[model samples]
Target: MNYKDYYKIMAVDKTASQDEIKTSYRKLARKFHPDVSKEKDAETRFKDINEAYEVLRDKEKRAAYDQLGSNWKAGQSGFTPPPSWQDQYQQGNGNFNAGAGGQGDFSDFFESLFGGGFGGGQHAARGRRSMQGQDSNAKILIDLQDAYTGATRNFTLQDQVVDQQGRTQTKDRTLKVSIPKGIKPGQKIRLKKQGQAGVGGAPNGDLYLEVGFNPDSLYTIEGADITTELSISPWQAALGEKVKVPTPTGHIDLSLPKLISSGSKMRLKGRGLPCKVAGDFFVKLKIVFPKSLSTEEEALYQSLKALATNSDKNIEDEA
Candidate 1:
């Protein structure tokens, strides 16, 4: 048997209001009521329409049917609920006897979601049971800019489903997720009904995505704090000057203190993230020299070395 999409059968969007659903169902039902309609397949269409209306009109039943997802299209075959499906949706003595006009046979799909376990109101619990699906988790890597500014990301996964032949198969499922601004590594985002489908109409489990930063050589994030290294020339460290530095959001001019040493840090308060209780952005200085110097540059360094040597000798003699 194939999974049926009640929303498609009712010719209404899944988001349609209950009144809208009822209005559409009436029009469709009257057109193919099998008594006054001349449309082909009127009898079959009438039953199908009524069946869909019965489920959609009830809030709890509609919500449970929605757990099956909209992927199950009308006229599609060779699909059924998982083998683990059980009969448990109709609780206590509650029964699914309601149908359009108080009379109409329900489909197997409906029975699966709502138990068909009542025969003349006697206890006839025959079929698989129902329960909430197991929650699932995954890790997602995002860019540094994503942390600074909210962004969207897409991910694909292999999910297990039972085919009509009672065998489990893997299918590729893609999801587009939103990454909120100021989200830190190790944080998780919850997606409802994106995990394993609940058995026999129980709501599907939630999916949680743990966020992490994509590998970047220039910057790193810890908690809400952001840190990056700024390379500077030896002269810039000694003389101090304004330099353009790269930040997560953009570049900005930063002044270095004179005689600043390598590993010295400069901080931008409330620039890290969250936009409230914001962390600080730290720029660590790294002073470096040219591997090969020009002749004039080499001469300047040589003179400085000689002057340093003379000064040390004079100090020693004075002592």
Candidate 2:
């Protein structure tokens, strides 16, 4: 199979963060979403974007892809995954399904790597008679605050199921689920009997909802902890100040220590996600200077520079 550069397809760098990948996917998905686009290759591009996102969005898949190295490019001839690639993935619990029922219109390259084309269906068919309904998987995007304080979210899941006559059909089901406080990303919230219906009156499979946070402009989550940048003026950082900072719970007065440098962090205990034990909220200090200095500001800066230069000379002389 030919090599496909997923990062290039998504117009992101290989080092792009999860948030950046999500942002790019949203922007491109809208532009080429087939139903909404007037472009000639809208359908094809849409499929490609989804295929790329299917791998890139997941941490495990992205890691496996990265292990393949950066030597291969799109349309590279005679490209193949490493000899141990299949074994590594098979042993791991990586979900190879690109989407519902693993029936997405993915490329041969993807199928070769992950092996979830017709093979998945064939495997399902073998034990179809006595098996319970296949477990359904879907993602729910919630705000960071939703994790702090539990929320009720509604999700529409599209699933493929076999009908009574053995014809496969697509069905859309809506579910309203309660998200528990402090739910971490990649954690599955299983809903019993909400999956595809089973044959022969067997019990229905459960639905697994993966918790994912929507990209927030102000905050980033790490486990139960939340981090955000606190921009302060140079004087405020140097002189220290009591600033009102926003947290997941609410706004609070944060005391910045005197002589605190840029990139320093202040921890607010018990302000993070309210799990069994509350996590801490962290504020990374960022000292910001005025883009343009006024006449008085310029004079003050020059005076400070002169004093610093003189101090350095005095120290040198004393040494």
Quick one: best lDDT, which candidate?
Answer: 2
Tell me how candidate 1 scores on lDDT. Answer: 0.74
lDDT of each: 0.74, 0.76
Clashing pairs in 1: 86-128, 86-129, 87-128, 87-129
- Count residue pairs with overlapping backbones in model 2: 0
Per-model TM-score on C-alpha atoms: 0.59, 0.57
Clashes by residue pair, model 2: none
Error of 1 at 205 (Å): 1.2
* Cα lDDT over the full model 2: 0.76
lDDT of 2 at 10: 95
- Alpha carbon lDDT at 222, candidate 2: 90
TM-score of 2: 0.57
Which residue segments of model 2 deviate by more than 4 Å?
Answer: 1-131, 163-167
lDDT of 1 by residue, 1-319 (tens): 7777778888999999999987897688668855457899997887787678767887766765676554334456866664433444444425453442212455676666554533223222321233345467788888988878898989887776778986667888999999998888898999999876664455787999998888889887888898899989988998999988888888989998899999999998888876456889999999989999999999999998999899999999999
